[model samples]
Target chain A: MAKTVDAKHIISITVENKPGVLARISGLFSSRGFNIDSLAVGETEEPTLSRMTIVVKGDEATLEQIRKQLGKIIDVVKVQDFSGLDFVERDLALLKVNAPAAKRGEILQIVEVFRGKIVDVGQRHLMIELSGPEAKIEAMIALMQPYGIKEVARTGRIAMVRGVK
Target chain B: MSKKSKTSKPVERGREPKTGSQILVDALIAEGAQVIFGIPGGALIDVFDALYDAPLRFILTRHEQGAAHAADGYARATGRVGVCMATSGPGATNLVTGIATANFDSVPIVAITGQVPTNLIGNDAFQEADITGICRPITKHSFLVKDVKELARVIKEAFYIASTGRPGPVLVDLPRDVSRAVCEGNPSSEISLRGYKPVYEGNIKQIRLAAKVINDASRPVIYAGGGVIISGASEQLRALAKKAHIPATTTLMALGAFPEDHPLSLGMLGMHGTAYANHAVMESDLIIAIGARFDDRITGKVDAFAPHAKILHIDIDPASISKNIRVDVPVVGDAKNILENLIPLVEPAEHKEWLKTIAKWKKDRPLTYSDTGLKPQYIVEQICEATKGEAIIATEVGQNQMWAAQFFTFTRPRSIITSGGLGTMGYGFPACIGAQVGCPDKIVFDIAGDGSIQMNIQELATAVNNQLPVNVAILNNGYLGMVRQWQELFFKKRYSHTTLTGSPDFSKVAQAYGAEGRLIEKKEDVRPALEEAVASPRTFVLDFHIDPEENVFPMVPAGEALDKMIDGLA
Candidate 1:
């Protein structure tokens, strides 16, 4: 059986901020069919350099090709999949779960296990803040469906390498 | 005046008065434009009349959309701005989708639209439309010519803006009065504009830093993007990769940057990327991104994406360097020119160990899919093998697109012309029309999906009329495969209106247009059908009844990483 697994592949690439570079990268993605998930970019310390964090979800085969292409770009500095390494990946999610006094305890216990904190406690609603892995947050949302999910504010996912050294 | 009337010789020597239509033809010829693809309209009668007498070549298409698409083909094929003229109202509106298509893909196109008489500008006159305003967002620039004297200059400006900077479509709306007016100016004279200035040179300081970083990193991977192809730097990229011994991967648009069969070539990257290609980028210490942007599909999860590597992004657009994914070293210049300079500065390394590791990863899991059922892959494979992997292909959007991307092994640049940026449904047929127009010597195939082909099916008439023959291989899955794939994965296969059960008989349709059309039911017939189609003197449309339920494997279910692909048909 061909087993397919999805993972977050993050890279902190640095490059000179010039013209047509984006078109090149975008053209690369489109022509090669590198389907990205969430892509965020910000300027780095140098005025001419910028940092790009790209999130893609595909099989291992796909991720490998994506890394190679991402790295090959003249503007790209580096690409890495920190999932197996010491990288902390988190997605911020805002959940508005319907909460009355009757089942508040059940929801609260579940939120605590997920390390969530209450942002607002209205008469019939409890807005909680949860920041964790994308899958975990997604699972949490699924479990709270019985409690009634009024709204959801998800900030996709952002990652940083983790280490004690 | 009285003396002139009597003197016969001087009176007869006055230059002939040119109609509005004549001026348009004159201006186009002066601009070095040889072709005009468009439909003849009542408002544009004068222009057509003049066009007939002029030296310019005009391809009168059946539909306005076909005309626009033909222009798209002409422009993309020749790397020159293609010109097409249409009347106002229905004629102009019919071209909206094609204009947007060119705009999204950033192709060099010039569209000319006729308008109502000057007196009836604001009123809803017959065959009148506010095309200038209507095409605002869809065009890089648009001009509404109220004065006939400014027609030539406006057209010149339109062409300049379209083909120069990040190529896109531009429109020039000519009112009836303006077309009829006498505007005298040399279209080829030295033109100046204080408004437009596009930067072509790179920042030296940044280029030097980029060179240093690349030289410092031992385990480096070269990631080529579509910019390499757009900038025509495939040779430069090849030179750099060979000299530096840096393994490379390309995005879809960058398919031709390096030969796919090359040992250094890791194949395409992103959702359906090969295991080795993604692993090399993930594991490498330094990533040299050339002319590619950091798209969301390529990076599964940013924090974890290529954590071990440092990125050096080179692009022509300043905003793209750090717009989506940040880069450590930003080199903004033309990909070809920049790579040419950087290749000489870097030290060549054997890196056999690193290359071996990547090869090991590649072997661990080749992009394998079983021919277990009736799917587009079967057909795509046959096409590749039949063409000996040396044919130019244009693909329409949907499952057929995915199949082509996965199964086709392209070895050169511009070999595959598909709508990657916009994913326009009907893009395959029109794009192939353009590709074939550009490279008629090579056997060109339009790998189309049933749903996508219907979007521009009218082009068959244009194909037959113009005698620009191309083989159209339709993977008739009876659904908008891409959208259906999405619904199956995310929406639990509710199977909305995406499914198409009984479409118009493609063979009958093709025959009606005076072209050969073949319908293949069994797998064995694919190759034979392909051969017959290619052998035909005229354009051919081969429709295959692929399994509608067949799904493209190696799919990354919406918010997952590249490694987490969903295998098998859903």
Candidate 2:
């Protein structure tokens, strides 16, 4: 029960797109001793507001507190934790793999298997773009490790409830 | 000018365009502000100039910190939004401790800080500081007003944020250029923040669950804190306790929220709290905690605190619920509102056995001190007796604060003002001045330690200049008594740097500030000095030389269980 309660949790927050809003949210987390696993924020469909997705690992109690504390900030409009909810989650990752001429075909085959796209090809590296769940991204990264991965940039998790209004 | 030139700006309703500073002043007046405790600097010269003819009374505090604390004290005493003003950089930095002090205790205050001109903001111009950023963590909310047109709306938002749910300090940093610029728009009176609405009503289902728990419990205790006073829920709390026949214990912040003289009153609970209160909490089957977070001071060892209790916590801040203690039932809303709803659902019960047990414990280990010499506790009792428990008492942190809390039977909400959460020294005098200003008809006293008093002792000049007639009772023990006590008990009496053998005469210091002073080395002179100081029309300091080796009784050493207290009776 404790282990289940204490696990990776993803929280989505909608806030007014004003100056210092990010600073306020980030500052609250730091002051409360909450460590963020990943954070992604951008302007929403409404130009006046921004949506933030924060992935953090904490117990149920701590998560509740984080949700409540986040709700307390004046700039934060709404907080929703996608726990035990039917949602479609996606994260984008760009991986620069060391694609040797001898192994280029093998990397391409692996990319095709994962439904990924080869966006940029350098003399010795291939920048592959993949959009999937975090676990799938991690699995791809694991498979690319033997092929000598150079660097990776990942956009943190973003999710939408299925069949929402 | 003679012909009303067409090139001039158009008048709005026969009124000329107001400067940003004038708009700020007008906004404050519109918000119903009566006084502003502040200091003027170069960046704030325009605001000060505007304030010169403004209807609001400006208090010139000796330091920015004093101004902040005075504002906090005024807010705590009167339940109104207290306002303080200071310049940029160092002036704003000086208000940090006082701001944090108010923030920790959830006092409603608006701190207005002057900034360098907009163009010079990030250039590290003279007296420039990122005050909004500096105060971000300490304040409930903060704003840096760059445009003069937004000044009125920002001020409205700042006040609204500061005085609303779970009230706390808010900061507004105004650039010098903004202050000087013309604001053509009318000062905004309405505030609409999409993200700032507070939940005032508790969920009916949760309230019913809490009331059911209260009705079923055989040994229940009501633990109340500052929220009771802030929400004006003391009457509701008292009614519930009487109806349920459950004993009640208050935190230091909740001292005056529940009358200590009431039969079911457990006085105070936690470190240096009443023996019966601690015992009752530890043995309670149900703990209906209202407006009070289970601070470490109250729950000594997290796992060992109230080991047998099923906790029901009520508060306005949702984060505060179950943050420290795992609450069984949580009702997140205003205390008064929640209590009003819960009171009707609660059924009456006697709990004769529980009350008898608490009564026996109270009788067995009542708060006591050796009445032989000039004890600080004795001095506190004398002051309480002199005031008939009606004076608004402010206290600096340490032994004196604990003694005051222990001795005084606080019967009214907002009557006892002390730095509970932050425990900041040098907070009392300025707070006392603010309290006196807020409640002019009532007597206000600052019970202070010799060490803590000196931290912000310069506030005497502010009090004297304003003719506040506030009294200060200095419990002079020639050392940092609380630290010395810890050393005596825990550190084998190393005594380190706690001693102040050559401290200046406080009475003489008071006299230097053009206020009356009296030195009392004997217990016989304690009451007389208090009377004289209370009667004096000017600010007065009563320096009472007390026992150097005295320690606060019923102390649960840090990290020890609540019941593991150290005292002669224990």
> Candidates' DockQ values?
0.02, 0.65
Candidate 2 lDDT by residue in tens digits, B1-570: 535545555665757788989989989998999999999999999999999999999999999999999999999999999999999999999999989999999999999999999999889899888988888899999999989988888898888899989999999999999999986545455676899989899999999999999999999999999999999999999999999899999999999899999999999999999999999999999999999999999999988989889999999998888888888999999999999999999998999999999999999999998887899988998899998889999999999999999999899999988999999999998999999999999899999999999989999999998889999999999999999999999999999999998889999999998999899999888888888887888899999999888889989999999999998544
Candidate 1 Cα RMSD (Å): 15.0
Model 2: residue B122 alpha-carbon error in angstroms: 2.0
Model 1 alpha-carbon miss at residue A147, Å: 53
Error of 1 at B406 (Å): 2.1
The segments of candidate 1 whose C-alpha lies over 4 angstroms from its true place after superposition are A1-165, B1-20, B184-189, B300-305
Give, for candidate 2 chain B, the lowest lDDT window spanning 10 residues: B1-10
The candidate scoring highest on TM-score is 2
* C-alpha lDDT (0 to 100) for residue B209 of candidate 2: 98
TM-scores of the candidates are 0.73, 0.97
Candidate whose lDDT is highest: 2
